[model samples]
Target: MNVPVHVLKGAGGKAAEQMAAMGIETVKDLLFYFPFRYEDFSIRRLEEVQHEERVTLQGTVHSLPELRFFGKKKSRLTVRVLVDGFLVQAIFFNQPFLKRQIELGQHLIFHGKFDKHRLMIQGAIVKNAQSDGAFEPVYPLKGDVKLVSLRKWISQAYKDYGDEIEELLPESLLESYKLIPRAEACYFLHFPQDMAKFKQAKRRMVYEELLMFQLKMQYFRKQTRESTDGKEKSWPAEKVNSFVEALPFPLTAAQSRVLEEILKDLNSPYRMNRLLQGDVGSGKTVIAAIALYAAVNAGYQGALMVPTEILAEQHSASLKELFAGYPVTIGHLSGSSKVKERRETLEKLASGEIDIIIGTHALIQEGVDFHQLGLVITDEQHRFGVAQRRVLREKGIRPDVLFMTATPIPRTLAITAFGDMDVSTIDEMPKGRKPVETYWAKPDTLPRVLKFIDKQVSMGHQAYVICPLIEESDKLDVQNAIDLHRQIQEVLPHLHTGLMHGRLHSDEKEEVMKEFAENKVQILVSTTVVEVGVNVPNATAMVIYDANRFGLSQLHQLRGRVGRGSDQAYCILLADPKSDSGKERMAIMTETNDGFELSQRDLELRGPGDFFGVKQSGLPQMKVADIVEDFRTLEVARQDAAKLVASEAFWKSEIYAPLRQALEEEGVFRKERID
Candidate 1:
């Protein structure tokens, strides 16, 4: 019986269950889940090893020590082992299992790096058989389980089911690429006979992974184009221009260009799907307001959906002011909005009394309907997925969709994920805004920085002291909001302080935020929740504690918090690392402020996994190809997928018949059904 692949991937439990969520459901996925690094366990003979050195020996146990408890917490067991006439002492902690495996005068093989005073094998898996072969295959396993058993299980699993897989690529392409067969790739990946086979299989598996991804993207793009007519109803420029002129800040040239593009999409009868991504404070909200202005003027309502209530309120207030004194009616609906008020808002929306509405997910909830919501706008669109966007689109007469994000996505990634939409990036920041001065600070610099915030506050400026964690917990040691709040209260007792985090109730948060916005509080302590919203123009300093705890894009976003106003803003990244990656993150912080540049730097520092981990980066994994190294292979896969699809419509082609059947084989995740 075939259970859902999700159920099977979870059969292993806990550690691997997440693979299903990542769309790694089949033997093919397991093959492509390549190891980030390897633990080399090749052993040298005891004669080649000195005391306190790591040495792998193929010898027998000459003597076994008694397995006795030295203390309630410590189990003492030691034995003298002979490696070609050289004596070495082996020890185990609470490991009678090792004693059971090796009897006195038993021949066994041991491989581990040696230390200066004793054998320093941090993690070693031993076997009872004696051999002088090359390094054995090791699988990624956890707990107290030994590597030998993992090797055994994998060997058996593959022997029983590996032969079921059929090659999914064309014969000529596979031959020219020198790619391994699907079955052999799976076999070698698990238990490679040699290094050459491991590399050979890895190359083929990576390419196949990318090819399958490209195929899925191609299908999704085609489906989207067919479903959308690219038709839009016209909204005049003078109407929106008059509204823009009435705003406080003049619309920048980039913002003007985006408004025209949106107007073009709106005027056309064809459905419009577009991604409008920009850097922080690049005036995307202004562009959105212009488009919404045009939408309401075109005799239809507009809905602006944001991820959180604070953002919704911000948009509603800004746009409400922009549309004020006009014929269009504007309102908001959020979780905190009272029931009677909500009912009235819904009525107004349903009856077409409201021309513009801004709210969180509450806008999409039941009872909220639009008589003619011709357009749906999602702010910080990365927070929602294609499904959520589809729900918004369906709410009206196939409303033209506009998605706005501050995180500038790489173009390749935008194509793969947002393939259904045309992408427009507002790369320019407004003039007169100075670049944020970023610095890598040590723990010792904390007091001086607090002094700076103190100075800023003293000079009538508010600041944001952000932490990664909300509160103290046993699981993690990062400085939480609660702890830092107390620490700051004690140091800066004269100033009023307010704390905001994810755990607080909605009303409670709104109240505290209102106090901060009204300047009732001089300094607001917060978590990453304040990364996107709660804009206070007077807040001049944003000091992020443990900045390395966040990804590059996130750190940049946090920095963006302070630079909003004309005041000299500073972003201090506090990190002292024990690893190279940590140091690299600090380097990225100092390198460039451009989100696109930072995104590529981040991709180089991390990988496709990082993109998935922080989907907000909006980078697409460009096929089984490495954007950094495998461009040639990726280009080949792209050409092949395009050629085959164009030549005979791969969805129906004889060459792709088996591949189509393979897609149905349940081992796949995020499979795109051919239309």
Candidate 2:
């Protein structure tokens, strides 16, 4: 059944190369090249067609096709067709060759959008024969692959190799899930008789995809839990209490609840794989600090890995302040650290002198060793891949792992993407944290906004002016951080302005952030690099230029930078959104400050692609399943996959053999075993 694309009809030379460019080299790949959308081309009478709708009509040509040239390079073909006693004009733009195919008194089926103003059909297709009342699939195409050529090739492929494809799901699952046969679903997905059948076919395919993904995730979780044994550490309640009581502020109920959950996991025998998700300024660091304190009290070392040097430095400084009176020693490691500093830090870490080490990816470098490392915590977990996390955890013997993300994700998507790890959310902000007031303004309000920023600066508070781009771009019309920094300095004249962006060197970024944090810089103009972990409690206002260019979650994170302190914070969005989506994003930012709610709205508005990079989630790319649209199907599949993983007899059955082989081919089991 693994036939090459070249063997298919008309797939030769250039055609074959085009197919290969789309990753369709085999018959299996062809089958999985699902359509992005479908169009209905069933024949309809002229009277049945609606204005501004796309439809197919069978009619006889009443007038010969005439070509008219608007200019030297542009020409259009027009003809009149008679259908059910109604005459309608058909227009084809830039297709002069269509004049020969359409003739007077010839019967043809036309498909296109109906324009009521011109009383014409802007025809995309004009076939000599009638359609068979079936939906036409619109596929994602590559270079030189015409729709007609692809359609013919696909038809020939199905005729020659459709029967060779074996069913991937078991008969019991098909019956229980009310799913059609795999071969039948494939056929119906490409050419459905009606919308109902298409829906059923899509459902079957989506269910299969989700089921496989969930099975793999569950299998990895089960394998890891059973194969790896963790250190049985005692949770000294007194020590944890003392650490919490020493905090300058009290913990919210949500934080307390999540901390209790983490404590339970640390005391358990199985190595912990947990995800700590919270909104900005939700106090996740305090929870992590308490866990590290418990690990150190249990005679072990802990390491916290972050994504950037400034974040690592920030965490180290904050932890040092939090553990000021404690006996625990903290070490910092980053790419910018001097050689002597790194060497001393490593030596201390290996000798058990450093109880807790905080650093960036530099902590995972070769020769960096840990003495009695019992816990590993990664901040902004999405920034690191599975291999990086594994490398850090391998520094110790099955150390408990905790991954934290301030980027709030929709609950359903979190379940689908991070199904292998347990989840804990700090839903409530700490006491004295004020909700930031948000507003949306146009570009004309810049002068007023600059004046407001100056006012905040004069009151001994800092402000962040965010730009969408780091530098000037000929392609984009938005302001850049570097350019905006100069403009702010020129306009404000008296305020101390600083620039921060991702392109700066690590040490340079650290210095800029340090200045901003110490109140030396009253107005900081930066890019989204400051969205993650730059904490300045004295910052009171934020002005985001072209705010519509940012996603809702990103806008929320930027807004979070200002509201960390006791003063009332304000977020001003300066954007003139032309699209509905852009306007909706700006309005949502102005409406609420809840990250979780905004995350759900963001998924609904921008889809999974913009919300979370699918490639970075470590899940297989799905052909039919959408983590946002098909969340119910995902939940069902997750439950079924868990049940299958729990039942030993199912693994040995012949019905499960094919699925096991498929999973193995995808390297799911290999990655599990290696990790």
Candidate 3:
């Protein structure tokens, strides 16, 4: 991990200090930050050159043409440099330094793009001709970073300190996976001798990183398991069934299956750690409500923790209605409640008066206590870290945990991120929740869309117009929420309109949300901060401005804010019509309403960065792990690692001792205890 300060300096001078700002401290970090792309310097045959491509061809030197300037300022210098075998025009606008770099009759390795008329254009790579040019990895470079110099520097680094790199993974896992040597992975990652080793190296690194992450997760799950009493509340499943039957809508098969899985955990002595994956309008709350009912029936209180006070209040209100006739008093605890009210709620919770409590992080605060908490449910599961959830669990009597999320994660990411939990997905939306109608439009079409919203508002319906920008910014010319709020006010002057963005105070935000929920506001203009933990049943429309700026999962979440009620939801994705990417995004939105597929698309488009960003538990630190590129390796590693770690045999193995110590390390990813 120690990068010589000299490598960045080129000659080991003050230049080294500049690259440090980018968080590039070590050679290892620099090496691992592989090229986002590569410019192939290997010779391309010119006669068969294709248009709009990077090509290299070897032939006798064609005549070097004139370096011309076409601009009025005469500053635009265009250099047409001929390759060894072919004639091509290299057009550079005001690029004088490029002319100095090019030479005649040198047999130069010319690397650039060619258009239909053999015009070499745009940003392309060129190099000195070499007799033997291996697969050159053009790393993401700085002042003097290219395929050639970077390789030389990295070769120097390995030549000096390659032996010093400690093999981090266990020997058995490494051998069993047929992984490349750790040093080899590092070496080829920077300058791969061939593509086969390059691919293999990527696999090894991905597997190594995922394995470490999986092991850390297993450690935490195991550590938490030790403290639990292996106690399960023996409540009649029939009561839950009665509650389900009593509901107005029938439970989907997915709901029924997930509930059975939950009941099995409740019946068993083993403490449960389960994830409930429900889509946008899926009925995760009902299953949680049934679990709460069971806990109360067994004479023990339960708590449901959501990420936001707004959602907590929403859950509390719903549960109160659901458990109306049942012998249970529900308590709502949140920062929004008055001090005296919070105290009253906490005291009732400490006593036997409250059967179920729902709130945000306020429920886990110092003064709040639960007399006998038997079950705990967390909505939007990724919002809270393992430590935060563990603190909430400590509030209960070894409460069995049920984590629920709307983000339809691919199973691999779910297992990787929440490996400790046995996942249960209520994949089907409740029978009647209509799949939202989706559309992609431009700002120019706003008159028609606003008219459409006006019609809906006139018909006594509500809509959410989401803006990308929060406020009027000097830097960005895009529409801001406050400005848009004012503009929308002009169109729908008589109707109730509300603005909700992250900049608003918590109280103001809550008030606006309350107003929206009560149908006080016919239209709510907002930012993406509304992505998490908002529930409005009456609102049937979601209009996202600059829809291309959002990821698919985030857009889905925003769309989920509406469609909670029986209303047919409409998710209108509004963006500038110019971008092809924007068009593609809108198409994804209009396509099948499957979270799994959307998540996969998201991963493909943006890589696994979205998963880490949402998880917010700290990024999985697999030095070699890339869930996208080397997913197969990661899967294999996960299977092997899970089998070993879950087994008693793992503890007895010679490698297990160090592996356990690795898990115990301060920053090594498991159950990190911060004072």
Candidate 4:
């Protein structure tokens, strides 16, 4: 089954090149080229077929096929067939060569969609003489590769080379799961005899894919826990209590509990690989600050990394204020730092003068060293990958890592995506944080929304006008920020408006954010650049244009910008949703302020791929299993993988040799360090 592609019949240089472009270079690839859809072609009499119904008919050709040309590059082959005393005409487009093989009075079978009004079939397929009445599969295709040629090549390869395919799953697993042999699964997937066979084949493939993924995740989890050793620093109760009392507000119950969990992990011997999840404005940062305080009190250093420079600067200022009365020294480093300033910060860091440093990816840059770095905490952890986290941890021997994210992930996804790390959830929000009132409107209702913004601004409040794009796109009809700024200025000439986007310079972005935070800019028209950490408590009104284009979690984040203060806040979603999914997404935003619920709904609606891009999720692309639709299968696979990894006999047996080899070749075990 691993034979060269050229060994398959009809796989010449051109065909092989096309196949290679589609990630198919071997006979095994051909066997795994699963179909996107299947069409029922079981035999049916012509007279019994209804209009617009797909059917397969067998009969004798009434007349010879005729080839007709409509233009220089357009041609069609027309043929007549008599089936059960009914006459039907079949047409094949751009297939003039079919006229040579089809003969008058010859018995043939046709499979296609029937048109009873005209008694004609638009697209028809002539079955091979040896083919029986079976379902037809429609495959994902490359350029210029006809379905007939691909089908014939697959059939020939299966007949000649299928037996050579080696099964990777052990016999015990197969028997327990009731899975068919690998070769038969491949065959049935492409050319199933019936619906039952198709479902069984698909089930086996999905289970295998999920099982491999779970096994790899569990293996990495165990490896990282055993191979790494962390600092054993204790959190003194009086020190933690004094730090909490110095804070501006009392800690929420949820935050206090999660902080206890972090303390327990820090005192343990194993490197802490933990994820702290909370909703927007749920006070996750305060918990991180407390953990960092414990590290510094224990005569060690801590580091906090964020995704954006603005966020880094914000954290630096906030941490300084939080540790005002303490002896801890906080340093800030970013890409935009001056040369002398960065050098001085680096030197201070190396000499252990700085107890904690807050920055962006600049923290991981060369020449940045820490003296006894004990803890590493990353905010908005999804923006960074496992490798980046490992690099930062490498700066120290084995630092305890706590990753914080405000974008809540559903529990089901957290198990598969972040199964390697322990999870902590801060489900409660701080007191006095009111849920922002959300509403939906169409384009015609913009006047009412604009009036509301004007009223809010008149009340000494600010507003945010968010657009999906900075510039106009010829392909998309959504309004751009630049144009929207102009329109807002024209509509409400009294209000001061400013524009900000990713294209702006770092200094310019910082200036705009500062102006907004100081209540200087009453109306800030921008893109999603303000989605993360640009917090302005005075901004009470947010109008998102084309809101349907954004995901539910993202819309929630944008809404979080407002409602930060004690005043009533409003988020107006201006969108004319065209699809049912779009409308549903908009409705979900209006229905709930809970991030975890929205995340679950978002996963169910957009699936994991769009929920978190493939790169951020750190999950390998699946071939057969869908993470959303096959959650039950995922659970089963996860349990089975745990059992397999726990059994030493299974790992040492010959049946698992191929599985291990396949995993190694795929580099599953050698992926980024979980820590």
Write the residue-wise lDDT of candidate 4 on 196-311 in tens digits. 99999999999988988888888877765765467788757798888888788998899989988999988888888889999989999889999999998887899999999989
Ranking by TM-score: 2, 4, 3, 1
lDDT of each: 0.72, 0.87, 0.74, 0.87
Instruction: Provide TM-scores for the models.
Output: 0.77, 0.90, 0.84, 0.85
lDDT of 2 by residue, 1-675 (tens): 577888886898899888999989988788778888888877877677778889888888998888999988788888888878878888888889888777778888888899766778885577658457668798889999998888888888888888876788998899998999888888888877798989889999999889988988899888757764888789678988978987888889999999999999888888888899999989899999999999999899999999988789889999999999899999999888899998999999999999999999998999899889999999998888778988998999779999999999898778777888889999998777789999999977898999998888888899999999998899998999988888888998888899998898877888888999998989999999998878898999999998978899889989988988889999999998575557989988888899999999988887876677765765456788888899999999999999998898668988888888888888887784323
At residue 251, give the lDDT of candidate 4: 89
For candidate 3, lDDT tens digit of each residue in 1-675?
Answer: 475547543725444554454345677555555544444556766656688876654433344434556666453434455654346655555556656765565455555577747456544444556645556665555664345655665677677667776676678767776888878887777767777888887777776667777776666666655545757688776887788899977889998899889988887777888888878777888888887887778778888899988888778888888888877898888888997887788789888798888888887789888788899888887788777888998887778888888888876677666676678987776666688888887777877888889888787789999988988889865788998899899977988889999889999999999898888988999998778878777788888887887888888888888777777878888887787666776788898677778887887877666654844644454445566766676677667777877898777866667666656664644446320
The 10 consecutive residues of candidate 3 with the worst lDDT sum are 57-66
Task: Quote the positional error of residue 233 for candidate 3 in Å.
Answer: 2.0
Residue 378, candidate 1: how far off, in angstroms?
1.5
Best by TM-score: 2
CA error at residue 596 for candidate 4, angstroms:
2.4
Identify the superior model by TM-score, candidate 1 or candidate 4.
4
Model 3: colliding residue pairs: 3-27, 44-56, 44-57, 59-84, 59-85, 205-624, 206-624, 206-625, 209-622, 230-269
- lDDT against true structure, model 4: 0.87
- State model 1's lDDT: 0.72
Name the regions of candidate 4 deviating beyond 4 angstroms: 42-133, 245-250, 385-388, 577-581, 669-675
Q: What is the alpha-carbon lDDT of model 3 when measured against the actual structure? A: 0.74
| Decoy 1 TM-score against native | 0.77
